[model samples]
Target: MANQLGIYGEQQAAQYFLSRGGIILGRNVRYNCGEIDLIVQMGGEVVFVEVKTRSSWDFGAAESVTPRKFTRMKRAAAAWLEGQPYRSVRFDVWVYVVDKGAVEHYEGIDGGAS
Candidate 1:
């Protein structure tokens, strides 16, 4: 049930991105380092999205994105980028509170200047 909700959250996040003019390139992309929830393209830039979902906000959904997870996401994104055409890239976090079916999107979560 939890896994199903997570998948449903991912689907919601995908629609959210798409509604804002993003083109989803992949979903649940796995690499040696980790898995990326969604890979998207908006305008001319590539976006690596991380989706965090929770049944309730008792504990914030985005709060679960630890530093370790961020590092792994970066590594996975780097690995996924290898051999691909050069393009500007971004990292985004999509938080879904499933109980409310609300999505809060954080764009360019990686503050490091690209």
Candidate 2:
């Protein structure tokens, strides 16, 4: 059930991004070590986004991405970029609070500068 909710949240995030003029490059893009939840093109940058969603903030908010997860995401982003057509890239995080139906888009949350 939680997994389902998370997937639904990712879908919502993808849609929100699209509505905000983000072009969808890929979804659930996977390499050997990890998977990127969403790949989008915004402005001139290829954006790799990780989506986190939660029904409540009892434990913590959805922004809680661990170091291990970031490492995996970085590896996945590297794998993705090695075969991509873009020269510039950025990593982003989209946190969706399900109970509030709100989406917070955090650009350049990882992988250095925007």
Candidate 3:
């Protein structure tokens, strides 16, 4: 059930991104130690995106990506870029909140030094 909700959230985010002129590059791309939720290109920038989905803010907001998570994301981004054909890259986070059947997006949260 949680996984399904996550997928739904990611789908919603993807749609939102596309509508905003973002181009999807990859989804659920995995490396040996980590995974990237989505890879997108917008305004000629390669964006490594991490999607966080939450039912509510009881624990915290969806943008709350821990340092460990950022580390893993960075490692995955490195692995992804090693085989990619891009010269520039950036890290972005998409926070999805599922509220009363509505999906909200908070895009481009800084992951720090990734």
The 0-to-1 C-alpha lDDT of every candidate, in the order given, reads 0.85, 0.80, 0.75
Residue lDDT tens for model 3, 1-114? 889977987897788779989999899999887998988888778888777777865634443676778788889888888867787777777666677544545445455422
Worst 10-residue lDDT window, candidate 1: 105-114
lDDT of 1 by residue, 1-114 (tens): 989988988999999989999899899999878889999999889999999888887866676777788888899998989999947999888889977877788888763211
Instruction: Tell me the TM-score of model 3.
Output: 0.82
Task: Flag the better candidate by TM-score, 1 or 3.
Answer: 1
Tens digits of lDDT, candidate 2, 10-92? 89988988998999989998888888999999889998888888886554543367666778888998888886679888888
Global Cα lDDT for candidate 2: 0.80
Candidate 1, after superposition: displacement of residue 51 in Å?
0.4
Cα error, candidate 2, residue 47 (Å): 0.8
lDDT of 3: 0.75
lDDT of 1 at 25: 89
Kindly report which residue pairs in candidate 2 clash with one another: none
